[model samples]
Target: MKAAQCSDYTSTNTYESVLTVQESVPTPNLEYDTPPAGFKNPMLVRVLSVALAPGDVRVMTGDTRELQGPPSMPYTPGGDVCGVVVEMPKESKKKGGWSFGVGDRIAARFVNKPMGMLGEYALVSPDVCDKVPESISNDAAAALVSSAAVAVIISDYIKEGDRVLIYGAGGGVGSHLCQAVRLKGASYVVGVGKDAKRLKSKPISCDESVNYTKDDAFNNKEWQDKPFDVVVDLVGGIWPKLVDQNQSEKSIVKSANQGGRYLTTTPDSAIFQGRSVWQILRVFLFPALWRATYTRIGFSRSYRPQYSYVIGLPSTSDIVTRTLSLAEEGKLIPCIDDSGPFPFTTEGVRDAFRLQASRHAKGKIIIKVSEK
Candidate 1:
């Protein structure tokens, strides 16, 4: 089997230096029988397409080592996968009414160690895998596994007829979040990002687009005339500053109506990079503590919107099923970065990671691992 393997973390070097395509890597070995009490056997999957995300970059560059520990050397680097089941354990027939079989197209969040779906074949647990509908393409299915799941989870916060604002609204999760909120009955959606054209385009189709690169990015009169009922911050570092006493009336916080919810996916840092233990703790803990105290004590009512962090919980079968169902229903469309579906190669993978790390990708960065 061929696989793209990372020899070491890219902390001290470029991604090109550490990541390479090896022609002869061993395929994952699977147990035919379930012998363990708590463990379920993993199914072997033939990789079709994989998506790159900020978390993948975090792990590759050793930014998350302190929190997630180190990845073993020469490891594959993708978690969002769309693949076909090539092998299944005998116990699968008797377990949890398993419906997947060999050759069934599946999309999964493959988080097992060392071996990942970047290779020709990888092991996937049925728990995190869901059948990809015939209507969904492999690329879209791969992209949906992670970002759309987060968007689906976040959509639960939206209420009918609410006016919503989203930062980084052109990125993978952001694009999906926009559609999800619309599906949830938000009266209006505003997407903020560097690329206004993409943010205003189809699939995302934000009611209004604000380009943060401009000098008067957040100064739109519409924001003040009709304040947002909910603010989803995919870009971090804005919420803490918004709540500061030194903030002026022109602050982004002022654009949201008092008592509106401010939800964030990245509370600690917007950019993933190597950080010291103290840095990580202070960034996450301080804001979290302040949010809790401020809301509980009623300080948030007068000063700012209610704050809450959006933790990317482990993918569940229900979430995956809902995401696919939404996709099948055309309510949620996976937005692939315009620059990708990069070819499966050494350079292609590196370029995909480069685009993802740039934080400017219009949507999900996908690497086409194999043809369907």
Candidate 2:
């Protein structure tokens, strides 16, 4: 078990390190009793890896510590992982739970501590594990899970002939969201971002692009007349004071707020009152944000599922079969930014984090946690 370990912050130049993994690395046992937690999951590679999430960072926001410690300590940040299931909870035999077993190569999102896809071996609940779609490679599988889901979730309200716009439409999630909108056949797809470097690499159905760096972007001649029907805001910034209620019909804000300073998603209301636009705010933390709240706002007719959980995880079999078929067709293009050989062995993890933190680097970043 050769894994990278982030011992401290000073010596971070070494992005490559070797680790000795025991046959049984200490894993958090989540069984109710000793009913049958499971066996050791292993990686037969001297490795490192992590999924690139520009939004998520390894922070000590609330009672944080190193990955290894009490259950309450910060978990590793292995959000989007594509790895083999070497073992599973014995309780997996229970009826109507996650259908996973040993050796099933799967892709999933995890949050607890911050082992983010860089750990060679990880202990993940089956709920987070979905069988890798036959359509994507292991690396692509690891890269696209979180970003792809972001695309899928935002495109839910789309209609066949609707016009769509994606802000920050060049990053991983914004890029994929644009592609998904194209796949579903939106009438027009517009992409806006800070520059072209990010836009050049993304595979999107963008009919137009607007670079909002010209001092007053919103008041520009191009944007003044070309208002969109649906705007997908992926960057956290000061929202517009008012959006035309009549012109821009709907919107989805998919980025995380940069804390209290940025009054993100606040103007969704004025969309109707000021701009005559029917705005829809779609955040990824949970669907609960949209529900009863939307009903209270009196847009119940626009919301879907009638109740919540309507857009739950799709069938694993379906995701695997369909995505694999799409992959074969070459319809999916995941922009890859970085791949690593890591545990950060003091220097390894910090360097990886530094690269990941850069505002550049389009597509995804991955570390080779296990040999494919």
For model 2, the superposed segments whose C-alpha errors exceed 4 Å read: 4-49, 54-75, 93-100, 111-117, 195-202, 214-217, 241-329, 338-348
Clashing pairs in 1: none
lDDT per residue, candidate 2, 72-190, as tens digits?
32223445567777656654443575555566677665444334244555555455446665656776776666566656555665657656666667666666777777777677777
- List TM-scores for all candidates, in order: 0.90, 0.64
Ten contiguous residues with the weakest lDDT in model 1: 31-40
For candidate 1, write residues 249-338 as lDDT tens digits.
544443223557788888647755436767776767677778856764654466577777877556357788899999999888899987
lDDT of 2 at 361: 42
Q: What lDDT does each candidate get?
A: 0.78, 0.47
